[model samples]
Target: MPQSSAQVTAAEISRIAGVTRATVSNWRRRHEDFPAPAGGTDSSPLYDLETVRTWLASRGHASAATPSEELRTMLRLRAQSGGSGTSEGLLLVVLAAASHSAEELTAATRLPDTEVVDRAQRDAESAADAVPATGPVRFDTADAAVLRALYACVRDEGGQAALGVLAERELEDSAASGAYRTPAPLADLLAGLIPGSPSRVLDPACGSGTLLAAAARRGARELCGQDALPVQALRSAVSLTLTEPEASVTVRAADSLRADAFPGLVADAVLCNPPYGVRDWGHDELAYDPRWAYGVPARAESELAWVQHALAHLAPGGYAALLLPPATAGRASGRRVRAELVRSGALRAVIALPAGASVPLHVGLQVWVLQRPEPGGPERKSVLFVDTAADGPAGPPAGFGGTTPPARTRGTARSASVDWPGVTARALGAWRAFMENPDAFEGEPGVAHAVGVVDLLDDVVDLTPARLVRASRAEVDPAELSARVDATRGDLVKAAKSLARAAGHEDWSAAGASAREWRTATASDLSRGGALTLLRTVPDSVRTRAHAAGGEEGRPETRAVITGSDIATGSGPTGEPTGLYDGTAPVIAVGDVLVRAIANEGGPMARVAGEEDAGALPGPHVHLFRPDPARLDAWFLAGFLGAEENIAGASTGSTVLTVSPGRLRVPLLPLEEQRRYGEAFRHVHALRAEARRATALAEETARLLAGGLTGGQLLPSREAAEVRGQGGDSPH
Candidate 1:
């Protein structure tokens, strides 16, 4: 390819050269021989990749990259020439070719470029039945590098990995980047929620057929799905067939709500994770949609429309599980539908998941487990409500002991670590129990409760799991509450005292005039100097091993994954290691500095691994910096690397700032000075930790006190000690 034919930005050059983006700009400015802009706007000029690579090689700049990265680069370069339609068409080629054995793929890549293209075109045609064609599939000799890279990616990284890149191109290009696959754990949970093992399953708004595949695992011999995106529909059809070759799979490309693909089909069950909060799901046109058996969903209530659609496709008494945003459970506009579902006994259970469970990771989403009402069957008496979001099992009555991410950190808070297995178990246990005997089911207090439908049918018809489950929290053991309150108060008092001491221990003085300036080195520079090591978990790699014996509990072979949430919240590692990694997860030792991968919020960015954090594996969205204690101080490194200015300078991307490890710079200082600063930062970390713990405890105590008061479990403080200070503040 001509040097000008393939181009990249300064960021891409930085990545290829393993240097900071600033370094690339510096090279462009200072080196007259540096490649000039080959294309793109003046503000964001693109350099020829071949020219840049040659320049970097001549200068002895490091450029040791893996084949996966090479493939990604080739794909990016190709995307510039090939439009999205071509990309979609090419994806079919990938899925088709992915079925070939690694040896077969490797052997094909060694052939002449012309032969490779011909072979790839044959592969695309061969899987026509598995991956239905959305458009014509074609490849030129020019695409040979991409063709070889594609097969290599499938051969090395796995087919799903290659497919993800292609799917991402379309999603990002179309500005639908929020599209994400349902987590496999959540998929299994949804599949397990249905009362019986469904033999014929349907997912109306299937994305990638995750739910349908889950159903397949549960012995569903006939699987059906519909999606609005052709790419997704094609991908799902192939994925479902691959997952269950014996199962009959039918996936059509069409908006299920706007265009009913299976209007007359009935299924044993429906499992869906539909789009949320969409206003134009053909609502005005679908106002009289027969699927609106419950009620005509308001434009804002697209979730209810999906719920009814699932209901419409079900056999009588067949169950449906839909993952919905929390708003859907309590939105006033959907009250009529909620009431109707409750009255007809169609709505069975509403389970709240911990935040970070899936996309829209910032919000704690809910799962609505519903069953179509069978005519002349048993009358529905109550609705089951389970709250996994709160600490009471947890929620406001109790909650996951996770610190709120700093106001600036927007998505995927530490609370995401609330145990997935625990959440699944609790939800499934309550659901199975409820289904077995709805009338006699007495739910676990503070976690789950079965509320009479009459109570739910009240004016609001609000079915938020936390609200319903919270009322039962007051029924939590009074003795347990009293003991917890007293113990937590003591701990809080100790933490308060510690916070005060740490705050008072600071001994540094600010520079008098201009802020102090010092020569600094990027973290990558330090790594080159052997002062630190960077480590990260390949989430995809780690999931393969998730099938091992233990979970996040740290068994003999199991390692707990320390996620960004755990670092931000000062909580124990909550990420369940998906048996995902190949070998061992990056092990954290004391003195290892951890940084959040994204600069989304204002919360603390880094913390030194304490004794409690040792031995745990680093999770996604967490960057690990294990400093050689002899050469660097962990706290000192963490303090400077996590500074707001440093993170801001290092981060890239609009809307979501992703920190670049190679860009994070720290000041060069003597070991003695570093120790002094490290000590102070240590105290600061202690102070912050204590403050977060104290705040959470105080909140919990206040909740307990309020519940106690309202439930008549506690008396007024008539005998309480009075304050001695004269100020009104003391009295208050």
Candidate 2:
């Protein structure tokens, strides 16, 4: 097939059109102008890109597609040409964009197609020269459109956008399974599990390099990664280079276990979300592999193999965090290895993350934090076990040490709606406490515990955190629990009153005269005029110092980092600041407007930084907009930018929505007029905060009350006694 004749699925058409998939199906059934299928099977047919564009244009739908979507269509066309050259060319374009400023990329992309292609080829060659280890890349006129799209994507959405396009195309081409990405929060959690700042980090199965990126953010200087897929390796390389340009990165395309790319490499920390459940993981071939410091893993215990692989790569006393399936803790075949790991003090902690935290969301995944033991280190006494599954929404399933299952499911287990911040706090707190004093660690009831090594080396070596945490909770003093319940109830009552006041605050009237149309300017336009300055975290690079002070290799001093999750959850910064403070990370200030670079369905997408948020640096996936107070009102900008429609309109991507800060429209109104709206928005924010507090308090009160009653810690009041007397029943 010719490159220009490539076809896209109906789903792709819907994505380009910014509509539901059903809308495209309706177009096909109802409109004769709809493009006919060029190829593919009945259930999943493909359409010619040009034909679809022509049809969409004829119906005035051409303006619906974002630049990224258009570029995706073009890349799909090139990919269907029966060659991988176009993706490589696009990769080159991304590299070039990263090398140059956003303005430079925009200027180059604006040139004639021939000139753009020529420029892309030159830039690609230059990028290859800089990274001499990568194979040579070639670009031609056929790649011109993609080059332009790639430039636009990088400029408008950052390098990750371009990487995402290439990754999607490659994943589609390869038809890879078990290819789910580690959510940023989960990756951060894994990286945080390491006891100290690691100078060098390794992720053996570094899919898309998300974990490596997270590690880098945590001040890891030298990053090593290996993946079985070439595209993934290439993607990780480009992504890391672009985002963490200062970091030294080496990524290889080969199975880490089979090829052992970094055989002699011992890193300060190793983080992996390895592929789960592979019967054929070279068990026979690696029978004598020294990486298995613990008992040899059974063929069915591939997760255990990854556990050991991670451990093997860790420097003595270094930590390794691996995301594994729940069954890995108790699977009979892996009991010997689990017991050995426990007895040897290699396993430090087992954290049960909530379901929906990662892929295969039905099962709550576990993160096993291990330490490569020093030959003469003090005998390890205990391992931290934390169960955050019941700490968030979609609480543990029936008989999983949680309250009785609700009549109706709150949501599908696959939904990404878990309380990540709470989970991180609980797990980290427990781990830290246990690390400080394992023997005397007074664990959080029903949440975390430090289990003795002797207890874990029993007949059935079940290392599940929930099981251990539940047993520990049962040992808590009833009087202490009652006191806690009393305190929580008092707090809940106060919260209810506050919520009522905020909810009743009605300060604004409806706009008259049919919504009052007004002219507007984009955030980019305002930035150009110096009305505001937009800032984001600099990519990790060896040239740049790590965030924390006293970092290895003289890295820069670190500061508190405000993550996107923190903004979404309306919490203070929770992540450790590990990157060098080189002024690239904007220190947030009161009156500044902060917007999440990624859009979510139900939440305020932007916030006016308050006094509490001031002095904190913005982290990755967050946009900081500091307005010239004389020219712009922070609340006004946040009010409009955070609007659901504005966010939806400015976002790109099919699955995860990436916000285009520069393109987000803001109303052009006088400061006085803006203040009125800002005040209203501020009130709304207050109401929301109060409501959230009240809801949390209510849930906590219910849980405590239930626990108190069920555990026989509290008795019914006199009112209940009178009711029993009326029913002619004697009190026991």
Compare the candidates by lDDT and give the number of the best one.
2
Q: State each candidate's clash count.
A: 26, 16
Query: Which digits, one per residue and each the tens of the lDDT, describe model 1 over residues 195-249?
Result: 6678989988787888887787677899988888887888788667654656898
What lDDT would each prediction earn against the true structure?
0.74, 0.76
Runs of candidate 2 exceeding 4 Å displacement: 1-84, 100-119, 122-136, 152-158, 172-176, 391-414, 508-521, 525-559, 575-581, 626-636, 667-675, 715-732
Any idea what lDDT model 1 has?
Answer: 0.74
Could you say which candidate leads in TM-score?
2
How far is 134's C-alpha from truth in model 2 (Å)? 6.7
Model 2 alpha-carbon miss at residue 713, Å = 3.8
The true-versus-predicted C-alpha distance at residue 198 of model 2, in Å, is 3.5
On the 0 to 100 scale, the lDDT of residue 253 in model 2 is 80
The worst-scoring run of ten residues by lDDT in candidate 2 lies at 400-409
> Each model's TM-score, in the order given?
0.73, 0.80
Provide the lDDT at 86 for model 1: 62
lDDT of 2 at 8: 84
